[model samples]
Each structure stands twice: as structure tokens, then as C-alpha cells.
Target: MTANVQNLNAERYSNEVFELWANQQNLNKSEDYLLKKYITDTSKHVLEAGTGGGRLSFYIEEKGFNNISAFDVVPNMIAHAKKRASTNDSNINFSISDAAVLENYESNSFDYLVYLQQVLCFIDKKDLFTNALKEAYRVAKKDAIVMFSFLDYESKIYNPALSSFVNVLRKLRSEEQSSRHLPWLKINNDINWKLFHKNQPKTYWVKRAEITSLLEDIGFSIEEVKNANQFSKNTGKRKGILYVVCKK
Candidate 1:
């Protein structure tokens, strides 16, 4: 389900976008408190998936947890993060690796693994998304904390229609709009969503039950499906983000 080079290149973690994102994130205060409440002392060695701009690294470090390793699929994002690393001397391990295939990390090495900002949605294909979860499970210690977020497509604002399909076609053909939304569905428990971002390939939106079942199938024990908006004042589009705290 990898999008072609044409689609992948659109807004694909460019330096300009990441700079704006990082700048806005630096102003956020509640995120630190949110992570602090969930992260504990047992998570000495932490791994973060989809380390966009490495903003989470700062909040993670602020809580006195230094042994942090993070990675992103985009080389540009990693380069920017590494540059930011040079200025802070945080020593965070930032690398380039796809979340779907994390061949670099060792099994059972991490106490905590996190993939935030609705990162799973980018893995639009259900099979690869499952494989990614399987990889995350493989890399975590037994009973380790596995925290991540999912974007719920059941939001009222989301109305996938013919226009949405047209938008996707335009994107794939590079004829018109750079980005568009397509339908999202729970086909027998496997989640699927059409590409919305102009860049990158694959898209996925999930239901709570579908995601819970997927995690259980991957051998993770359920802890709680947290509503993340409670921790922040996010509304409208941002309100769909759901944080899942599970054990592996």
C-alpha cells in the first residue's frame, strides 16, 4: 500500500513544515504533563516511533528520562532533528527507519515504546499496520508499556464521498489538488482509510473496538483506551485523537 513517489513527495516531512510544527509544539505546556502522568520510572529505556521534529524528546527529557531513542521514516525529519540535537546536547538517538519495518532495534530492549500524533494513520494498509504493531511488540520487553495514538474516523466532521475519491485521484495523477480525503471503514475489524495527506502513502483510521482487537491479536494486554483530548483543549479536527495505553 505504499504510495508512489509522486504522492509520497507531496508535503513529505519537508524542513519548512517541520520547523513550523516544532515551533508550535514548543509553546505547548500540557503535553509535558500528559506524558508525565503516563510515563513512570520503570521506563528507563524508551523508544519513540514517528519521531517527527523530536518535540516529544524534550518533554521526555524534562521528566529526567534520558535514555531515549527515536526514529522517523523521513530522512529530512531526522536531519532536522539531529541538527536540533546539536544545539541541545540531549544525546537522543535519532535515526531514519520506517515504522513498518524496524530492523534496527533489538527485541525486548525497550521498556516503553510510543508512536504519537496519530502515526498509525499513515500506515493506511491494515496488513502493514498489523505488522508494525507486531514489530513494536517484538522490540519491547515483556509487560512493557506500549503507548500510542490512533485517529478515529467516526468523527462527524469526516464525510467521505465521491468528491473525496476525486480528490485522491487528482493527487495520484498529479492533476489538481495535492491532498484529499477518502472513505474510512472497518472491514471486518481491519481498518482502512483513503489517502488524505498530499505526501506519503497509505492512510488508516480506526475504531476503538477494531484497534483493541488488533492489539490483542498481536499479544498485547489491554490497560486502557484513553481519551487524549481530556488532557488538552483540542477540538474539531484534533478531537479525534485517542491514546491507547497497553502492555506487551
Candidate 2:
């Protein structure tokens, strides 16, 4: 299940359309606020996980951050980011690496870590999610600050649609569905308002308490938990998505 989820996510993000879309995006309000508020030292070594198209990394570089290392599991996304870096003449280190396993990064190396864009919730199972969190803890320096985002299970937007039906069928056959697994089963027309639908990867929606418990268990001190919209004072929008800051 883990391999399948990983492969599907890689393929989904590797799509040319999605890559272009990701590349064009800038730091959202929550991300911008967190970076401004928490990351005071730009010269310190920073690591970013699931850095799709180098969006956040590019933003950080523009803010005078010199020692930044960013990685994404999808090869094409990393390739696109490298191309962007070359075009911009930036020195941000971009690589292909999985969040669940940071085999290439040294322990206690990064002074800060970035895991935004709801990247953690993409892992299929709880154990793998824990492993990913454990990796985050291992790679961070003492007192290193880490910021991550997750899809909120309490948000009605994440309530199972295709997953609900799929899980019912699986249960009838005595087959287990991966926990909190919700697939992108609806049409998204955000690209120039043109409707398109595709069978894509699943993302796990997590309860607020559940993620906090896991982070604390993995030895991170929780700093703050806020709805993504709170940063913009737009409390009514995107209510179920959350961003959290912690210290190692």
C-alpha cells in the first residue's frame, strides 16, 4: 500500500499540467506568515520536504536564505525545480528524496525544516506517517524549528466521497482499506477554469489531536496550531486545513 501510494503521488505530480501549476504558485498566506515569524536566521541550514517545483524554497531564497536544501519524491518535480533554479541563477540545493526516508541527509544537520503543503498527510498509513515524522525529528538540530501542514479531518471538505463507497465495497469483501485514505475523485477546474478529472493519488486527512499526539510522541515540542486561513484573517475560508509549528 505504501509503495502504491508513493508511486501514484509521484505520477500525479509528474503530470506536465500539475508541474506547471505547481511551479507558478507562490507562498500562500499561512506559509508566508510562518516563515516570517519563525525563521529569523536565514543563514542557517534549512531542509524542505516535498518541495514541489521549488515553490517554498524559491520564496525562502528570495528572502535572503542562503543554505537551503529541498527535496521532492517525484523525479520530474525535482527536475523542474532544478531547471527553475538554473534559470533564476539560485544556489538552493534541490534533490529527489522521500520524506519517509531521508537516507541522503545527515542526522542533526538541518537548523530548520519545512514540511508545508499538506505533505505529511500524503503517506497512506499511520505507521509510515510516524516514520516520516521520526525522520523529521532525526534530521533536525536541537531546538530546530519545523513547520508542517495537514488536511484536517474535522473539515467537511475532507469527508470521504469516493472513499466512502470504495471502503464499503472493501468491507463487504473483508478487505482492509488504508486508514483515512481519501482519493482525488472529483473534477478540478482551477486551471483556467477548464474542467478535468483523473484517477489520482489518495491523501490522508488527520484529526487535530491525532497529529499533535504523534508529534509529541516523536519528541517535538508543539509551538502553535492554527488554521491556514488564520494567517490571512480569513477565518471563514479553508477551515479544515491546519498548519503547525514545533521545536526539536
The candidate maximizing lDDT is 2
Residue 75 displacement (Å), model 2: 0.2
Which tens-of-lDDT digit does each residue in 62-97 have in candidate 2? 889999999988888888889999999999999888
TM-score, one value per model: 0.76, 0.88
Those runs of model 2 whose alpha carbons end farther than 4 Å from true positions after fitting are: 157-164, 173-175, 187-200, 234-238
lDDT of 2 at 35: 92
Off by over 4 Å in 1: 1-11, 22-24, 27-33, 160-202, 232-238
The 0-to-1 C-alpha lDDT of every candidate, in the order given, reads 0.68, 0.79
Candidate 1 local lDDT, residue 85: 86
* Local error of candidate 2 at residue 240 (angstroms): 3.4
TM-score for predicted model 2 compared with the true structure? 0.88
Roughly what TM-score does model 1 have, to 2 decimal places?
0.76
- Model 1: how large is the Cα RMSD against the reference? 7.2
